[model samples]
Target: MLKEFKKHCDSTSLSAVCTQLTELSNQAFCVNNGNIPKWQSALDDVQNTQPGKLSFKPPYIAIDTKADVSGLTRSLKKLMPWRKGPYQIGALQLNSEWRGDMKWDRVKNHLRPLNGKTVLDVGCGNGYFTYLMSLAGAKIALGVEPFLLFNYQFQAIRSLIKEPIKAFVLPLKLEQLPAQPLFDTVFSMGVLYHQKDHKLHLQQLMDVMKNDAELVLETLIIDQQHGDQIIPEDRYARMRNVWRLPSTNTLQSWLEAAGFKHIKLVDVTKTTPEEQRATHWIGDNTQSIKDFLDPENNNLTIEGLPAPKRAIFICQK
Candidate 1:
């Protein structure tokens, strides 16, 4: 992944962020190719691991994600996991990764609203959004992703930049991403639903960012409450596609608890519906989950379903 990042940064022009790799990132920048017992188990839920399994095993990478860049490709060049392409940034990406880019014109403004401003991107997959931030003119945009593959991938992209674009890779969890609260804005999108502990995750993110810092949140939300959530037998690291979509009241309360004074729902894409769904954009993704996510396409009404409404919750610390 580090190699890929280096190549990407070299291709672009942001080498500053990755001048030095953290010790932890250096440790995780490689992949262990041999498959472990747990590796086979985690893949298909065939053989599950013990509830408290904490030991590291072979096959350092797991989860078949469609990341534009793959760290697994570094050690073993022959193993090319099916590549998907023609990526497009839409309502979801805009709400999440592109949220900080308040205005649209990327060329004119450089999308760098927080120029000379410290920034942190939690759950930054593939670091594509991080790239956008750099283009926008952010002084520094450090991305944090726990996935071994993604963590190194971000590091790799940083390594290549010609001009310095500050980024760091720390395997630390959201709850453990340092407590300095130095950033001016912390952005997280499509990340809250993936956390096993939603409340704690919320607390952790808020803790890392500075007071009066902007918290841009984008996640799947249900229009109405359902009695129960559909739990997947074995989902993404025990997380859900659509976990807790805290009601506007619940989210408002949590932000307040996290020392956020202003909480507002900036936009609701469901009103338009078509442009936002990944099916319209991520055609590769739709091949598997057909019909895509058009609520109008199908009369489906279940809370937290795949096609649940998505909203952006902006909070000021």
Candidate 2:
């Protein structure tokens, strides 16, 4: 495991961590064949990367032009043949123009000041978007996700960000987050619906935000009124409903319940320039999400897709 971690991630202090992890893994593994020794260094790195922080206005980063595919390859090699899903769509909606900060382009009237302030990104997969947020001038931007496979690579990508940017490999339901200062903004994309107890999970999320802290939330909306839908077997590589999409109304109500005063619907699904969204995850089926969005095609057929559309819901406090 330490060898895997070392192969994928690089940092000045990583060699030390690598050594520690190896010793720990061997000791634990030899002691009981019971559990795998898992240690995450990404979250803890935020403190080290955050000193000497400088403030600057962020430049727009349009991803339409080919991203340095090298970075994508680097992340994928470690993460494995994982596929993109609702999270990407939600990000597109937040920054439909793709200037890159996922802060819902030019919505400052509603968004609080974040330039050089601390920002937290939960369930950040691969850290691509987290990097963009840091470039957008967050004093310290931290991502929390539990997959060591990807977190390893995400940490290596931190160097590209001149400002403080860190990745934390933490469980979605982990009871405690770093407890020093509260975050100014939290970006949680497409993660709310994954838990079994929806209300409790939402409350737990609310616990992390400050009184007026911004929350850029996007998730699979399960309409509270209508019954929840399930993904049938075979449609997904995993079992049905690993994702529990929420309805717009339900999300809005939850925001209010959570004390987020201003709630707005950014868009259910955004229309990205076909070229901008092209990737290994999205194939020739340009109509993949488009087909799902057509109102006439709202039905989740035997073919696939619970609904005919991918929607983005950006709500804030």
Candidate 3:
């Protein structure tokens, strides 16, 4: 994957940072993760199957090709807890925990055209949206995911495709990328709340984008009645890494403070079970959004905080 990424980078604006990006990705891949062997084995199994063409099949990143459904399912299950997609391969349906298409529908039409654009997807789990960006005709869609498992999952999906798409997922974080104003469109979906310092996160996003580049920011948010923000004392919606939930107004202000222009809060939707639910594809821990909410009140999390309501803000750097 890095080889392909390097080749693609060499012919584009990313040429200047290709070597550094590949080296960092190599270091990340080399990190001792006990699950690597199992993940690699699963990836190898999928690669042996009949390759297919990838396309959007409504709620799925569909791959059209025949394969031993039972064997394919078993191999994919080895890389369990698929979180970001509900992909369809051949006759098999990998119904992941999150129906990512719902979120995609909310933001897709509002963004700038991606045709021939250099795009970046931060915190992209298994490159679900990255594939969408490439399918939308991006010159190259680079997805940076720090989680090693997701990278392996991405490779598993990529291996099954008959033809290579202009999308690639690397095992690196936003901070690891070179501070080059390169990407024309940058997406930071479901990532902002995880940062310890939201301002720094916004700043880092701004640093990597070209002037006038579009940024599609999506993260958990509170209603204006909840005040400017809420710093959770503990877990929010059963997610420990969530640092804070800001109001839409506050989020817009943060974008402005970071020097963004033409900021617009495009969509604000409260999460529902239909969008995030327990599915067999998620493996042993089938708990999902419904499990995280208070049994008596859907509007509150089990921890007595505001329920999961995400806001998508479109702006320019």
Best by TM-score: 3
Candidate 1, position 242, lDDT: 42
In order of lDDT, best first, we have 3, 1, 2
lDDT of 2 by residue, 1-317 (tens): 23444443343223333344445434433433221222133223322332222222243222222223444333323333223211221012112212233334423344456676667777776555565566566665656665444454444333333433333332222234523235668777656655666676656656666666677776654344444444334442122444454467766776788666667766554333341332443324433333434345434433444542234544554
Better of 1 and 2 by TM-score: 1
* Candidate achieving higher lDDT, 1 or 3: 3
Per-candidate Cα RMSD to the true structure, in Å, reads 12.1, 9.8, 0.7
For 88-194, candidate 3 gives per-residue lDDT tens digits of 99999999999899999999999999999999999999999999999999999999999999999999999889997899999999999988898999999999999
Error of 3 at 27 (Å): 0.8
Score candidate 3 by lDDT.
Answer: 0.94
Return the lDDT, model 3, position 159.
Answer: 88
| Candidate 3 local Cα displacement, residue 104, angstroms | 0.6
The Cα error of candidate 1 at residue 238, in Å, is 13
Worst 10 residues of 1 by lDDT: 52-61
